[model samples]
Target: MDGQICCMVMRVNLDCNSCCRKMRRNILNMKEIEKHLIEKQQNRVSVCGRFKPADVAIKLRKKMNRRVEILEIEELPVHYEAEQEAPIVNHYKYY
Candidate 1:
């Protein structure tokens, strides 16, 4: 398994009530032990009741036939970037 996990976001057309119900039930039944493990190391005691964006992506793919968009992706600690400090402006220099 690759260390990098893809985080996908999708907007789908779910037109039927039955499909919605099944999707909800399916989501509830699905479990990700690896995500729980990651959270456990980060001082997160309970994996339940937490937002699972990746799981949502899976559900969307299962229910809809549209293409999913990949948005706001970030790798682990190595790729993190801090905000740059604002530049100091001198009004006298422009005049």
Candidate 2:
């Protein structure tokens, strides 16, 4: 999924503050992630980045030693600015 951005929401068992902290640390270490949000009350983790959804789920499961359910996966549009061309001007010399 190169050059593609996506958001993945997963349900994880965040029973305690330590669990949330561990999850936060692991997510922070992932270089591909642009940002992340954790809802402790909902026991959900939302990650936005350029990585595959399944890969993240697997990594979280392995690292947390907990069951992670993929709740949703959404492909986000990438916005790029168009390059502007420089205007040309004619110069005249009079003798």
Model 2 clash pairs?
A: none
CA shift of 4, model 2, Å = 0.8
Give me the overall lDDT of model 2: 0.89
Query: Which candidate has the top score in lDDT?
Result: 2
Clashes of 1: 0
Full-model lDDT for every candidate: 0.39, 0.89
lDDT per residue (tens digit) for residues 32-90 in model 1:
32232112122211122223556655555655443434343333331321222356777
Candidate 2, residues 1-95, lDDT tens digits: the string is: 65778889999999999999999999999998988999999999999889999998999999999999999998866552112235667698878
- Which residue window of length 10 is worst by lDDT in model 2? 77-86
- Candidate 1 residue-wise lDDT at 54: 61
Scanning candidate 1 in windows of ten residues, the lowest lDDT window is 37-46
TM-score of candidate 1 relative to the true fold: 0.31
Scored against the true structure, residue 74 in model 2 reaches a CA lDDT of: 88
Per-prediction RMSD in angstroms?
14.0, 9.2
